[model samples]
Target: MPKILLLFAHPRYEQSRTNHALLRGVGELAEVTFHDLYEAYPEFDIDVAYEKKLLLEHDVIVWHHPFYWYSCPPLLKQWIDVVLEFNWAYGPKGNALADKTCLQVITTGGGSEVYCSAGRNNYSINTFLRPFEQTARLCGMRYLPPYAVTGTHKLTDEELRQHADEYHRILISLRENASVADLKDCEFQDDIPPQLTIS
Candidate 1:
């Protein structure tokens, strides 16, 4: 089984029911490591060496958070800026993250319908996620189609359960061999490539 580093970040985790329930389902899986960024460093002072070590240890890295202002929470942006060093995570000498897999698991208050061309958001979630996706590419990591749990504001108990169930299923699928080729089997899933090459 692949080792997964689930980097969770939410400013107001206490108020979260959807993300929390989703987390509860995945927190106990084998080879899954949970790291809450805000809980770890409330002051935003990240330890680079230690964070790099975690990246090295895991085969798959998951960024779990609620979509904030069409992107990630601030701490996540901070983590990427601080933890992924130039010569260590990229550049000629930076190959620490080469071939690793990175996936984004996000929760959104808006329904999926509103994230399309005709939707109020005016773009897909994947569109807003390009920055992250490209960053993963630069680090030589494969960026998988994001696993999204949308419509939190309107999700019924059964709907939330279904989303959580699919979440578990995708995590299991990724722990094995992961490729965008497999994304085709999932129709409603986004249109990310089978393999992404960093330029």
Candidate 2:
């Protein structure tokens, strides 16, 4: 099974019912390192060497956070600015992260329907995530479609639990069965086949 590194960032975790539910049982998964950025670096000072080490140790990297103001939280942005260095993550001799799979796991306040041409947001979620995709590409990682939970404000307890279960299943599939090819046509990880059959 591929080891997964989940970089979680949330400023107000205690108040977030959706994120709390989504991460209900993720910490217990074997070979999955759930690193809470806010908890680790409350001062917003990221440990570059340690972050790189964690990156090197994982086959799959997941940026799990709430979609804040059409982008990521400040700390996560800070992490990207410092941790993924030019000579180490992108430029010449920066092949350390080559072939790794990377994707975002996000939650949005608006519904999926609202992220379209006719909707209030006037663009898709994928459109808002281009920078993240480019960042992964620059690091020589395979950028997969994001796993998103939209309409967070209206989700009931049962709905949250179901989404949580689906999130768990997706992570398991990514760890044990799914490949880049298997995910190419998917618009979102939620669209992945239930069995996660590798083609």
Candidate 3:
């Protein structure tokens, strides 16, 4: 079983309906360490050593956040910049994160339809997440297609619960060391078939 380090970041978590529910769903799951970046470093001061240690300790790293301005919140970006150093995360000698897995769990305010070449956003969610994909690539990590919850503004409580249930199942699958090889070619895990049906 892979130990998942779920790093969540949201500036205004209290006001978020979808993200709040998603967080609650996985808060007590075993073998998944839920670390809230904003709650841990409200002042934006990240502990580089500790963060790197965390990276080394976990088999899977999950960056959970709301899609802010088509990307992640500032603190997660800062953590990447500061903790993933040149020689440690991505240099000729850096192999700490090699062979590990990375997953992004994001909530977007816009509907899924709005994030496409023909849509108002003019790009897909994966297109917008290229930087994150490249980061994993550079670190020799297998960047899995993201698990997204779109249309946040329109999702009802039950709809949100359904998505949250799926999120929990994804985490559990990862924890149980499920093979995600077939899912590598996918753009979004949410779009994959045979969706989890929880009553």
lDDT of each: 0.84, 0.86, 0.84
RMSD for each of the candidates: 2.6, 3.5, 4.6
Candidate 1 per-residue lDDT over residues 33-116, each given as its tens digit? 889998998889998888999999998899999999999999999999999999888999999999888889999999899999
lDDT of 3 by residue, 103-152 (tens): 89899999999987899999888888889988987998878778888989
* Candidate 3: segments with Cα more than 4 A from true spot: 181-199
C-alpha lDDT of candidate 3 relative to the true structure: 0.84
Backbone clash pairs in model 3 (N, Cα, C under 3 Å; residues 3+ apart or in different chains), count: 0
**Candidate 3: pairs in clash:** none
Name model 1 segments beyond 4 Å from true.
178-188, 196-199
State the lDDT at 13 in candidate 3: 94
Model with the higher TM-score, candidate 1 or 3: 1
lDDT of 2 by residue, 1-199 (tens): 7899999999999898999998887999988899999999999989999999999999889999999999999999999999999889999988888888887999999999999899999988888988998898899887777888999999999988888887887788789857645554433734322432322
Which 10 consecutive positions of candidate 1 have the poorest summed lDDT? 180-189
